[model samples]
Target: MLKDIVDVLADPVDGTPLRCADDLSRLVSESGHSYDVARQGYVTLAGGRGLNHEGDSAEMVTARELFLSQGHFAPFVEAVTERVAEVIDKSHAPEPVVLEVGAGTGYYLSHTLDSIDGSRGVGMDISVPAAKLLAKAHPRVGAVVADAWEGLPLLDASVDALTVIFAPRNPAEFARVLRDDAEAVILLADQGHLDELREPLGILGVKSGKLERMMRQAEGYLELVGDAELLEFPIRLDRASIAAQVGMSPSARHVEAGVLRERLARLPEFMDVTARAQLVRMRKS
Candidate 1:
């Protein structure tokens, strides 16, 4: 899998091109930097100082995998995959490179890669646990652990398409890596998302004006390519899925497990919760 997208990877220290070593167990950059491929098949492309922060914990990643595998968010995944297909179809690159920032567990990235013929993916996340899962998520995906805030450790103008779903995004870095025809597809949770679980589970709600703030932030690096699409769907979730949803989110870090369990126990057997998000497609200006 790493071999598939090795051409698009770069050394975090100096941005040199990377290639598989003699034995394929390690990657050596043009600058002579070597990063060992983990037994699970992913590589950590952080700077020499190493990762400053862990994005998601093992429990969180596990929760995410469990929750996502249940297909409650199938519509969201379908929308992302469909858009990625459109982007790839529009691009003339024979073998396009798809990059996903803060790609958790590689769920969406792997799905997109499967839909696009001759397409490879780079799944970038700061969490090692997430990277481990990402490495094996698809046959054509290469997983790397790197901070999205610092900058994407990718070659300039090397990416054909980028996707960000419920994760951190750096527009400047995106602009640097995406080709002229490439677009960055972002999915942001909107206000009233998961409203039914907010009061009952004591979880935080999506903030207002998030999309407007994001557009303002992307002003210099990226411009709107099309009208943002509002994706709304209803998920009938059980208590376990509700727990997994909470466990995989930021609220999981603040709430005590026992308290969260007690709150989830009081909920009904099934809930029709609203999952709402906006898909904004942007391109380098």
Candidate 2:
């Protein structure tokens, strides 16, 4: 519910404190900006320029939910939760605040919140469909629809830990919103991630120099805590699960439905695919 994380939310336009009003049907900012809460239990916190990016579609979101529900990415989720817990403990926040940017379906945020006591999360995404899922993903999560590039609609120095899993990153904004000792956990797709499915599925490949580029982008905002941790594991996926994985990625848009089905049919009934990614821990600089 919006009331759960209202204290951590801010006006998208001016960063004013926000509170539920009109019987919790809307959120009123201290600056007099009113944002209506959807009956479905989520709020859209776009600023004057409005959201310029479209996040994952409902179909894509559904595919993600399906794939993640099977616990195929358990290792990924575990790494995130472990690091987030450490950050919260180090900060000694009585009421820890975790924010997930571009949080899709709130799966990761939900899991992290479950693992940490006295912690609440703000799941911010640009998709309305994602917001609907996020609103109910967990009891302690407040869902908001906003453009990440524009800047996060959160108060400065309000978040104890921020996690971005296969999502967008706003380093400067993250630094501004994080306390000096707060941590940021980021997961990036390594070059070998899902290599088994790439050629057959005609999917996009992880670009080279991604880590270097990311560090350059975060030059003044953050610094690496230690070394990047590699989280690589193998999973046995059937044809159906493989299809769901492809559908949730950019490959779904590049291939025709019928042709993609043909390609999937030629694959083995079950395959051992490598799921690889690097987890980088950073602290505000």
Instruction: Indicate which candidate wins on lDDT.
Output: 1
Give per-residue CA lDDT, model 2, range 101-201, as digits (tens).
98999999999999999899999999999999999999999999998889988889999999999888888999999988899999998888888988987
Q: Per-residue lDDT for 1-285 in model 1, tens only?
A: 888888888888999999999777999999899999999888888886888899999999999999999998888889988988898899879999999999999999988998899999999999999999998898888888889987788999999999999999899999999999999999999999999999988889999998899988888999998799999989899989999999999988677889988998999999999999999899998
Model 1 scores a C-alpha lDDT of 0.91
Clashes of each: 0, 0
lDDT of 2 at 176: 90
Query: Which residue pairs in model 1 clash with each other?
Result: none
Tell me the TM-score of each prediction against the true structure. 0.98, 0.98
Note the Cα lDDT for every prediction shown: 0.91, 0.91
